[model samples]
Target: MTSDPEEQVRLQGFGEMTLRTAVATLMQLAPGERADAAIFRVRDDVRLAQSEIAELASHWGIEPAPNVRSPGLVPDQHWPDVVRGMVREAPLPSLMVAFLVGMLVARR
Candidate 1:
């Protein structure tokens, strides 16, 4: 299949990087409790993924995912700081693994 260049992402490398990290977060959460605080974190990552994808998709005149938050939600002081910190301080997938380990160990 031919790749569509118009659909390619070029501008926000950070978005792509964050998405890769979010995927790992999701996989790690698959077997866990929703009550665990990290599940909320995973949701945040998922929202970030959606937002980045939406921003990219919007330029193409496509209808982005419905659940994607308003741009304001992220660029704000509280959320953006944490999100950026997560991207900068740690690899998302690895963080999820550590979160799961901590939760599992704590339960024992």
Candidate 2:
């Protein structure tokens, strides 16, 4: 299929930025907080990470939309150590996880 090079490039850039934004947002929310966005039309890595994040939260009893999240939609802290521990100890999604790690490292 013939594709517009410019449009495709723009879409790719948008996708990368979206992932970066999500990582940044989640880091700001709460420690070891799990956030999930729609899987439909999102990047494979994004969908996978959200699913993993949800699972990880459940495993730790970190309920989603918890009392701290107000409407309980967002994370409450970076919880970097918890996230870092999980990332180090388990096989988590790569792309989003790496972005978040980079974000955390950059912050330090």
Best by TM-score: 2
lDDT agreement with native, every candidate? 0.40, 0.43
List runs of model 2 lying over 4 Å from the truth: 1-17, 35-46, 50-108
TM-score versus the correct structure, for each prediction: 0.20, 0.22
lDDT of 1 by residue, 9-93 (tens): 2122123323333333333332332113121122233223444433433443444123434666654579878877876899779
Worst 10 residues of 2 by lDDT: 1-10
* Residue range 1-108, candidate 2, lDDT tens digits: 111112211122234333333333343455444332322224233243455434434444444333453646665566887887777876557857888999999999
Question: TM-score of the candidate numbered 1?
Answer: 0.20
Native-vs-model 1 lDDT?
A: 0.40
Model 1 stretches astray by more than 4 angstroms: 1-88
Query: lDDT: which candidate is best?
Result: 2
lDDT of 2: 0.43
Name the lDDT value of residue 85 in candidate 2: 74
Worst 10 residues of 1 by lDDT: 34-43
